[model samples]
Target: MDPNSSKRHLINQLSPEDLKARLANESFKRTTVSFYKYVILDKPEEMRDQLFLIWNKLHCYGRIYVAKEGINAQMSVPDHFWNEFKEQLYAIPEFNNVPFKIAVEDDGQSFLKLQIKVRQQIVADGLKPEEYDVTNVGQHLNAQQWNNAMDDGAIVVDMRNHYESEIGRFANALLPDAETFKEELPEVVEKLKGKEDEKILLYCTGGVRCEKTSAYLKHHGFSDVNQLLGGIIDYNRQVETEALENKFIGKNFVFDNRLGERISDDVISHCHQCGSACDTHTNCANKRCNVLFIQCDSCRAKYNACCGDDCQTYVLAPADEKESLEQRLVFKRGKRFYKTDKSA
Candidate 1:
């Protein structure tokens, strides 16, 4: 059998449970890294296929999106193959010298399968490209500059969604209550309507969202706009290494199995189920009702890691009965599953 075919067969044969168990027992190290760049791509679909072949061969796994605008990738690569992976990535002219933001915490289970797709936009903000010059984004501020700007009382805004900022954010940062980036841009503009002349700051999980948002704001005539150079992931790394003041508190929400990483020893968010102060995010155990929500340890045990009592009861039903119930619910409600912003 071909080596690639054998590897594919092995991956296909393993169930999610089997994959999790295998990850737990594996001894090799894996590095989780994220990076994004906005540059014109002539053929994103072809690029997507090429990347998939390379990454899959190296057993790399994560979510990667390629678009005409650029590429946004959050992937886990085996430590032994890390150098080779970087070499191949940098060989692509557009991705040359792209900076990577490594995760602060790595458990080697951040992703279980390699997925690459071509999309309309790498980081969707629902903005027309002709309306705003995305290349002319906000000023890039390092950790020190961001801290100084905060100390100077600049109008800092968390450019991420409500659920993202609910768990962690910079002190005194204006967090818009919008759910998606598309909703956030307009709402943020409305919220800071009168402060167009004020020095504005923005940040997001990996800086991709901020890159677009800051451009949007600047196009709207917001003066003196700045953004954290690499977002919170890089900010936390710099804070620890440079001994800078950690202004961000609580857990930084991440899109992976880990859900989040502790930036500071503060539980700033509360459990949605019991209202206990907790920052841990978990998806409902009942897959059909996989709502992402914060849950306390006590509540986790009581509800079997479910979102509510209703989901808990659903989990208790036998497999055959559960399937029947799901079908009935789908017919009655027009959908078997519902998701929220909290959904991972």
Candidate 2:
């Protein structure tokens, strides 16, 4: 590591309040957007290093992962800095605006610090590039366009992972069962094969994965494939600006601290146990195992912010004893067959 570089530690994440205050003081307004491209990169290490240096200087902040498979990013860039950011990115032929998708809700501190890292696969679904045509991709559509097509009986599919889709999705969107990105790609194509000539609309968190995924489907002879132009983020912005009719209902799931952005103001997701209309996705409070699950505000308060009674007990104990208990209950995600604690 370079001697001039800042120290790095997993536990040393920046505080959200601190970041928000700094950006506000700077009068920095940022545009939240993202995009992806699946192409074989000859020098991932060199690319990662260069990207980190460039983005950091621009005061850009967001999560970005690059692999030999492709590059995926979800970031917030200062509004005044957008021109230079786009110029520097397009300077690399592999990425040109690449038709990026802007986030719907803008939080000054969407990400803490600039982090560019190399990985095996950008989205972490272990599938080889040879399995599908990552280069060709699918058609792009906006919220208005996607909604109209659905009115015509088109088959709309949510291209995001299970956790993302569970919180906010198009009312009638076909959600894939796969927990990862790679598995869902081929599965969605196969499921829509019968409707090769029919209008097949696809969407995702920020519209990055669907870009290449759509191209892959077209390469396989899917006659008609359309994607949400800016994903759910851009769709939300359009709804607010144009006073357009809202087609997508419920909270639009986000990966950042804000958790979710409510589009239609309807509580679609329920508290895992109480069956109340709540749309919050939370991490399990079990100290030993950090499994992710959902719970409403009421349930969250009653359970003392834990997922279940067992988690409540574990959390209530002293730190050392809790650690000991965690070591004991440390088995395979043992609660897979269990239901969300409703008794709280």
Candidate 3:
């Protein structure tokens, strides 16, 4: 009997506990990776289904979003099938020669299940086709070039949301105050209103956001605009490989079970609960209030990994009551509570 045969016959839907147990018992390791490309697609739904089928067969699991604009993917593939997965990906005309940015640190459980969906846009910058020409993006700087730009005192901008940038970023980078990519676009443009002609550099987690942002800045008449090619993940990898100066301090916040990867030994951010110097991000344990926040070890033990007293109480409630409360609160305020500008 083949071990992978059982997985092949398994259905997509599985209870969270069952999925976690299965992943734990698996013998082989998985490689986590992410990649994105901006290219035209005629039928994203068809493409999504095809990719889901192919990736599932390869024992891959993660979130994937495809659109007419392009595809954005983050997945964990079984180590043995990695080459086959890449070959199949390259076989597709659209994804041919696409560069994948492997995760800096992976625990083989970044995601529990496979999910591929079709969306309107890949990175959701809230710009209409008439608003900005994405093809007119700024210059792409490799690791060394990016470091040089930083040394030359280029105005660096972090194109990620406030929560994402709160944990880590390039030293002196302009951290935007917005919550989503949509809001960040306009806010960043306004911030650089007077310095359009100055040398402006932009970066994000995986370079996808900066790709759209640089185009937006250029469309708004920024003369000298550049983006860190492949963003912080690639930058960290290059810095380690080439022994270059790592100007990026603290952990790089990522969207996975491993919330971040340490680029340097600097803990630049403080815990939200205790105000202790920490860069670790964690979601509230209370299902009703799964707000993302920073917490130190002491705070985590005190709050039981919940955000506050109310959340701790909710999480400690009976299972049946907890589910009921979660339904009511999530329906009323959505799944997560976002801090307002004043509160933030």
How many clashes (backbone N, Cα, C below 3 Å) per candidate?
Answer: 0, 8, 0
Predicted candidate 2 versus true structure: per-residue lDDT over 86-204, tens digit per residue: 99998987776476767666776667666777998777655556655765567777777777888899888899877777777887889998766877988887888777788888888
Model 3 C-alpha lDDT per residue in residues 270-342, reported as the tens digit of each score: 8887687988888888654567888899989998987776677677788778766655443212233333212
Error of 1 at 11 (Å): 10
Q: Give per-residue CA lDDT, model 1, range 1-344, as digits (tens).
A: 66687335323356888777877777899999999999999999889878888887888989899999999999999999999999999999999999999998888889887788789999878889775787788999999999999999999899987778889998888999876789899999999998999999999999999999888888999888899998899999999999999999988898888899888999898887667798898887887767677788998899898776666767888877886666644221112212332321
What is the Cα-based lDDT of residue 46 in candidate 3?
80
In candidate 2, how many Å is residue 221 off?
4.3
Off by over 4 Å in 3: 1-11, 320-344
TM-score of each candidate structure, all chains considered together: 0.91, 0.82, 0.91
TM-score of 2: 0.82
Give stretches of model 1 more than 4 Å off.
1-14, 327-344
In model 3, which residue pairs have backbone atoms overlapping below 3 Å?
none
